[model samples]
Target chain A: MCTVCGCGEGDTKLEGQSIHQLPPHAFIRGAGGHHHHAHTHSHAPGMTQARMVQIEQDILGKNNQYAARNRQWFADRAILALNLVSSPGSGKTTLLTETLTRLQGNVPMAVVEGDQQTSNDADRIRATGVPALQINTGKGCHLDAHMVGHALESLPIDNGGILFIENVGNLVCPAAFDLGEAHKVVILSVTEGEDKPIKYPDMFHAANLMILNKIDLLPYLRFDVAKCEEYARRVNPNIQILHVSATSGEGMEGWLNWLQQQRP
Target chain B: MHEMSLCEGVLQVLEDEAKRQNFTKVKSVWLEIGTMSGVEIEAMRFCFDAVVGNSLADGAKLEIIEIPAEAWCLNCAQSVAVKQRFDACPVCGSYQLQVIRGDEMRIKELEVE
Candidate 1:
């Protein structure tokens, strides 16, 4: 049996009771062929359209509930949780390495690295001497709150620590789910086009902070930094943007300072 | 894509409803995906076909409805249509805005027989 919730195959007694229950109006199938309804006008050959009229269902509600519970747990521990989202090769790992190197020993830190297959990022963080947990999503495009909750159980939950969750490298799917983070940071590399923010506005709009990484490669690449910032601001004017080069450590002080201020 | 996981969630809900109401099969599904939800409609549709192949919703048709991003402008004290949450108010051009809606990806209803 799964000890946490007593849910697996070993706990057949608890599993016997089905949690699926229909609403009161789930029936009421129309007798005639023309079951006209205002909300759902379309009709199938055999299926009654009225049955589909009123279904007040919230699909993601269950996930949101778990996320709320996780949020409360983080609050109780005074952990500053951050969820990082970006595309592949966006320098999220490099930025995180630099951040951990700068903030190590100054503040207690932990990491939950999300990837489709490997524990490479987690290994990198472990090399930094801080406690890190790796979650191999295995074809999963995003990390939901439930996964984060499991990662938290194994992590060292010291008081006033910062927990950084590096979401699977994708700009689109990761924004939909909340990982009980205090803030969502989106990373954009200079090698990527300046139109990335405009092309994927949803990711930029959902983020609280945007990090313009790979500034060290600016001279080699044809990326326009001002245009990139402009498009990002157009998508989300409230987003705080910081330029940083993890390789040269250029413009990293401001990013570190911002992170330090977030620690409770 | 993440759609397979979402389809699995839908199947879980459908199976729960089926067991409760003694229903047999699902005919169609109505889903509402917000602009800021970060879900690709095409990918979701593709995954729906693959994930529901052996389940009760085996041949169910998936209908996706897109919801535009919207926010409440504090400066103008009104709700306005927005493409992004942080965009300034269309009328007032103020930076102050609270996102009131358009961050939902949900299964609205299921048509079962």
Candidate 2:
């Protein structure tokens, strides 16, 4: 039987046999199925141009519900949660490592590191003496709200502290689903082209803050720092841009100051 | 990669709807993908084939309808098609705009037998 539409076994006729015997939509049907009508439409045995549309079920509805619950939970506890998104090798882990190291013992912090198949980022954060949870997504490209809920339950976070969720390294898929964080921080490396914000504007536009990482390497590469900032601002004028070099600690103090201000 | 998870969600909803309506088999599935949702339609079709195996939606034809991006212009007080969220109003150069459509990913309808 035909699969595209479910109209194969009707009383319609084609060349010799019933319309079902012919391929789908072989004959042209007019407005009334005869000749001389206001509209000349094509119709086969089991195919009609009439679009069937009525049912409405939001695909992301379930995920959004869970995210709302997670957001409520975070708000109730007065926890400052941030979801970190960036491309691969954008220094997300390195920057996070520096942030945790500098804020260690000063503020109670927890980390949820998401990766395709490794605990290396979690291990790096654990070395800083803060609670860390490693979520191996297997083949999944992004972390959803349900995964964050589970990771939050496993990690030991004190009241009124920072919760950093390092999402899987993808600028596209991660922007679609919210992980119930207070802010979405997009990290960009100087090595990546300035057109990144324009090509992947959804991530840049969705982010509340944009961090330009690897500034110390600016002297070696031909990356235009001003153009990068301009493109990001063009996409999202309200996005706060910060430049930092995770290796040399050149811009770490400003980032630390922002972190301190988020504390409740 | 995340497409498989999305397909799984679709199958779950299909099962629930089938049980509620007492349908034996699903003939077709109509899906609406928003431009701003970041879901690749080709990947979704492939994932639908793989994840629907041995399920109620097995052998179901997948039909995808794309939704265009629409934003509400604060200055013009009109809704218009836009490529991105931060796009200025075509009528007036104002950045203050609210996105009203094209951010949804949903299953519109399913033809069942």
lDDT of 2 by residue, A83-106 (tens): 999999999999998898888888
Estimated TM-score per prediction? 0.77, 0.79
Interface RMSD of 1: 9.8
Cα interface RMSD of each candidate: 9.8, 12.3
CA lDDT scores, all candidates in order: 0.75, 0.77
- lDDT for model 2: 0.77
Q: Tens digits of per-residue lDDT for model 1 on A83-137?
A: 9999999999988988999988888889988887666788899999888888766
- The superposed Cα distance between candidate 1 and the true structure at residue A97, in angstroms, equals 2.0
Candidate 1 regions off by >4 Å? Answer: A1-55, B16-25, B68-102
Candidate DockQ values, in order, are 0.25, 0.19
Cα lDDT of model 1 by residue, B1-113, tens digit: 36666766666677677788767777889988887666778988877776666566666789888888788887899998877654678989875667777777777877776
Candidate 1: Cα lDDT at A176: 68
